[model samples]
Target: MKHLPLFALLGGMISGMAQAEIYKYVDSEGRVTYSNMPIRGAKKLDLGPAQVISSPRRGEGGGNPSSASRSPTPSDFPKVDTSTQKQRDQGRRKILEDEMRSEQQLLDTARKALSEGEQVRTGEERNNYQKYLDRVANLRNEVTLHEKNIQALNKEISNLK
Candidate 1:
């Protein structure tokens, strides 16, 4: 019957829509991969030989392909709120100054502890004295780090002006 050929053609069209052509590739390490998706980490890129599903070449489209695909160009540099930055710097400086004071207090405590520790004639007391010395060293390092941060912020503000 003439309807038989028409039904077979319709079935073929349905099957074409159901099946997807997977891309296959092999990396430099000789690892073969086949996927219906494209994602990062898989180096071998095969969007299939063109002409069937050709890529839009440059000049073929009115706009640059990158302009079309990419997000709007971000500011060349971050827009710094100078006033806000100065405020933040002031807060940081205050915190650092407080930390320096706290470190000085810790140093004083360690010195007193060591002086008291010297009077005690026991290995445990000497060990305790050494531990206090270590704490003082670490606190000094923290004070130094905070000072550096404050100095850096000052330099940045000066440069902004």
Candidate 2:
């Protein structure tokens, strides 16, 4: 009958669904094959779902109960270090002073050169020399700006104390 083929087809499907797939592979050394067994010497691995499956959690489904009622708040916070802050402030101030002094010395040398060049006789010579003077003036302004920055940083460090 035609029902015989249908029954056989259903039986085959049921049998296939009932049993999970069995993965087999050989190891690096000469050995026989294995099925559903984890071996230490084998390089390959099987990751079948039922072989290493995890069930759903209790609170996952619709009617599941929750063990934890609510999320937790902060228990405590760490304290800030005030004395180390003062040491950092002092170190920053010293670094600023060193940099400002270096910049000032460089600007002073540039201004001295500009002044000596200006002492030359006037004409096209003085015009070219005035360019050098302008350059030195710009450098002196930059040095002053750096000095101001150093003062501002010093004030910030003092405020932190």
Candidate 3:
């Protein structure tokens, strides 16, 4: 039983060391991709042995080099008071509300136009139903776009802290 455990441990270590080399490739669209499988014109990366570094936990005596050299927030940094921030938030809310109202109006107008188009058949529409369908599709798409815009604006307004 002791020899079996040792043999299994050695097998696991050997399998872990047999990792395939990673290759990087850039496609014609300028997008980079990395994979273990070989690709045409792929460049192999030599990522030497794994590195292990230990750092003391926060509040420990082992001083942090970054904290030692860090400086306080500069006085020149722009900061808005709470009242000023509130005013800015209110102004943003008002603009978004106005845009939402405009989008709602546009959606209503599009729905009305679509309804009118469906009710009345023009001389050209009588000759070809496809034209009428295309117009109706366009109007419907306009209404959907306005609705989506309104929803997005509402979501943004709600997300404001």
Cα-based lDDT for every prediction: 0.62, 0.62, 0.85
List model 3 lDDT by residue over 20-130, tens digit each: 478899999999999877799999878887798776666763476656434556899998999999999999999999998998899899889888878888889999999
Cα lDDT tens digits for candidate 1, 14-133: 776434445566787988887655535554444564466555566755366555654556879677798998887787777656665665675566556556644454655466877656
lDDT of 3 at 136: 84
| lDDT agreement of model 1 with the native | 0.62
TM-score of each: 0.33, 0.33, 0.53
**Better TM-score candidate (1, 2):** 2
Tell me the tens digit of each residue's lDDT in model 2 across 47-129.
45656655455565524333343333456765558888778778877776777677667666666655665465446545687
Among all windows of 10 consecutive residues in model 3, the one with the lowest summed lDDT is 61-70
Can you list the residue pairs that collide in candidate 2?
Answer: none
